[model samples]
Target: MSEQIADTAPLGHAKHIRSWGNWAALILLVLGAVVMLFPLVILALNAFKTTEDYNMTGPLSFPAHMSLEGVISFWNTTDFPMKFANSLLISLVVSVVGVLLSVLNSFALGIGRVKGNTVILLFIMLANMVPQEALLYPLYIMFKAIGLYNTQWSMIIIFTIIQSAYGTYLLSAVYGTFPQAILEAATVDGASRWQTLLRIVLPVSWPTISVLFVFFFIWTWNEYMIPMAFLMSDSVQTVPLALATMQGQHTMAATDLAAAALLSIIPTIVFFVFFQRKLSQGIVAGSVK
Candidate 1:
């Protein structure tokens, strides 16, 4: 009876301690979320404020007087619609091209069993080791020689080429783990090389592909330097370049600049919010398999 009571007391104490710990963790999590979210909250609030109101009122305060003046001014002054279109076009094209090249190269390396495959893979990996900035002038000259300078195609091609190496490496590693029996069976069934890859290999690798798609999309969307260097036309300026232009305009208010910066992030935020579940599922599937 004494031993049972002692055991029961400790178990009760442990239960209470665990409950307290859970509560503490929940509190900390909520606090951290609030801390991280505060800037975005402020930006959203400030977007509705007039430049004067934004300057006069504290960042945390409700707009002393609500006005869409800032948003209106931004819309009127900036070529936001055009910039948005340019950014979307560039990101989509680059992501698609980059993923395709990466997947093709990775598939070849993983399944080909060619004698020099390792050497080729090593060279590709080594290419990415060089700093991108170091390659800029040479790339610029090469593109110029090819009549691609200052064109959207120049930016797209550069991004695709640079991004392909990393993507290829990742996809190759993932493909290497796939069962060899599947490939053998596909071959034995008289499936051509293209048919085997298209029907058998790609169907099973959707999760890895999806993850890579999202990664490439985000990277291309966020790319600033390449676009800045290669796309010189005001009409072709991407969202980041447009943001930089906003900074250069002397008359633009700081609040408006902040508001514009916040506006630029909205598309990416919306994309993630919509696709987050798919992205998470892809990640889980890739990691588990």
Candidate 2:
């Protein structure tokens, strides 16, 4: 009986330790969430408050009365609809064109296994590692020479190249591990390389490509530095650039700036919500594989 009690005592102690560990982890996670969410809470609170209310009550308190004046002021001041359209167009074009470019590059390097593929891939990776700051002057000069500076097309072209390099690097590694038997089977049935890629490789790789598309869109939307350098005209400026220009202006209020920020994030939130199911599925598929 004493021996049994001794054995059970250790088991009980282990269980107690696990319980304590779980509670500690839970507390840490909860605290971390609050820390992350606090700024967002403040933003939302101030966005709806009047300038006077925000200054009087401070950011932490609820507004005396919610008002849309700040939102309306920001919208009209920034010509937000036009900026929204510009951001959407640039993001969409970059994501689609970038993914297509990445797929083609990956196919050649990964599945085709072209001569000196490793060297080419290494060069591509090195190119991507080059900072945007380093490229700014050269890109500016080139775009100016071509008369593409201060144009939305310039941004689309630049970001497509930027986003595709990383995509190619990632997708190449994924495609390298693709099953040879499938390719052989497709060949035996008289499928051309293009057909096999379109019907088989693309379908099989859709989940990964979808995730890349979402990421590329979000990344392009948030870009500031490159856009600021390349796009000079208000007509071609994106949401981030617009917001940056609005900052610290004599005419703009803190509540109005908060409102602009709140408005700017709404599209991205909606985009994520719309694609969340597909995103989840891709994540699960990647994990299983």
Candidate 3:
């Protein structure tokens, strides 16, 4: 009894310390979330307010009455529908094409017996490490030469190039988990490489693909730099550019700007709401051999 009490005394003390540590970590997380979310919460509150209400009370003041007028005005000023369509088209096209290209490139590099595959993959990885700012002038000249400058096509091309590298890296990691015996069996059954890839690999790898698709979708949707640099026309402007132009000289009402920001986030939020479960599944599937 004496020995047991002695042993448990240290264990009890350690357990008490661990309990306090867990509580400390949780409190820190809560504080961090509040810090990050406070601005967004403020944005939401002000989004429902008017400029008059904003001026009369304070930025943090609860509204005397909620108003939709600012959001309506924001829609009018920004040409919201056309801007939305442009962003949607660009993001969709880029994600689809980029992810497809990544799948093919990843397969070739991850599973193929071809000579220089590692060298090629190394070069591709190096290409990914090079930042867009470094390539901007060259891309501008090339696009101008090809007559794609200032067009949506330029955004499309550049987005594909940037996104495909990351997608390839992600798919390769997941593909490395595929069973070699299964691939060999398919080859022994007289399946061509393309047939094996299409029929065998794709079916098994779809969960990872779904995750990559959504990841690329979010990245391309939020992309502002390429579109800003390339898309000069108002007709081709994306959501970020549209929202950005609302700042400065055009000088939209602060509340209206807040409203517009909230409005723009709706689609992405809906996407997450629907696919969040699948995202969890995909991540788990990719991780497990």
Candidate 4:
């Protein structure tokens, strides 16, 4: 009877301690979420509040009356749709073109070994070591000399090259272990190298490729420095630059600025909603088995 009571008391105490720990963890998590989301919450609140109310209350204050005037006024002042379209188009092209080149380049370097040409791979690695900003001026001069500066072609090529190099680096490690048995069988059956790659390798790689697509797309969409330096026309400017142009003493008030900021984030939110699953898979896809 005494031993049983001793065990029961300890078990009950442990259970109580665990319950307290769980509650403490939950409270901490809720606090952390509130801290991280506080700015966005403030932004959303101010976005809907009337200018008078926003000015009268602090940023965190609850709106007495919500109004669409801030959103409507923001839409009126800028070419929001056009800027969105530009970012969308650029991001799509960069992801697709860049991933394609990465796959092909990875195959060539990692699997297409013919003459033991390691120097090419060495050069690619060396290129990646240099910061892109270091090459910006030289690239600008070369692009200008070649009459490609300030063109969509220039942006497309630059982003494609930069993104593909990183992609190739990632994918080469995956393809480096291509099943020799399968390749040998394909070759013995009179299947050409291209056929084996197109049929077998590419199909197997689609998941990883999809991940790279999202990665490059997000980077290209958010890229500000390159576009700011090269893209000259206001019509061709991307969403980030367009949002930046909204700032000034006279141009945008607090309410309108908050509204525009919230609106700018909607497309990115939609993008994550669509790609979240595939992206999660891709993150783990390239890991060593």
* Best prediction by TM-score: 2
lDDT by residue (tens digit), candidate 2, 1-289: 9999998999988765657779999999999999997887888889999999988988889999999988998888888999999999999999999999999999999998999999999999999999999999999999999999999999999999999999999999989989999999999999998998999999999888898888899999999999989888999899988888888454678898889899988888789789888788778878877
For model 4, the superposed segments whose C-alpha errors exceed 4 Å read 1-38, 114-118, 248-251
Better of 3 and 4 by lDDT: 3
Give the Å error, residue 66, model 1: 3.5
List the candidate numbers ranked by lDDT, top first.
2, 3, 4, 1
* Model 2 global lDDT (CA atoms, 0 to 1): 0.91
Estimate, for each residue in 1-289, the C-alpha lDDT of model 3 and write its tens digit: 9999999899878765656779999999999999998987888888999899999998888888999987898789889999999888988898899989999988987877447876877777899999878888999899999999988888888989788988887777667767899999998999999999999999888877878778877888888876778888889999888888787437677888889998787777677778788788888875675
**At residue 70, what lDDT does model 4 achieve?**
80
RMSD of each: 4.4, 4.7, 4.7, 5.5
How big is the positional error of residue 187 in model 4, measured in Å on the Cα after superposition? 2.5
Segments of candidate 2 deviating more than 4 angstroms: 1-31
RMSD from true fold, candidate 3: 4.7
Clashes of 4: 0
Residue 68 in candidate 4, Cα distance off native in Å: 3.0
Give the CA lDDT, 0 to 100, for residue 276 in model 3. 88
TM-score of each model, in listed order: 0.86, 0.89, 0.86, 0.81
Candidate 1 whole-model C-alpha lDDT, 0 to 1: 0.82
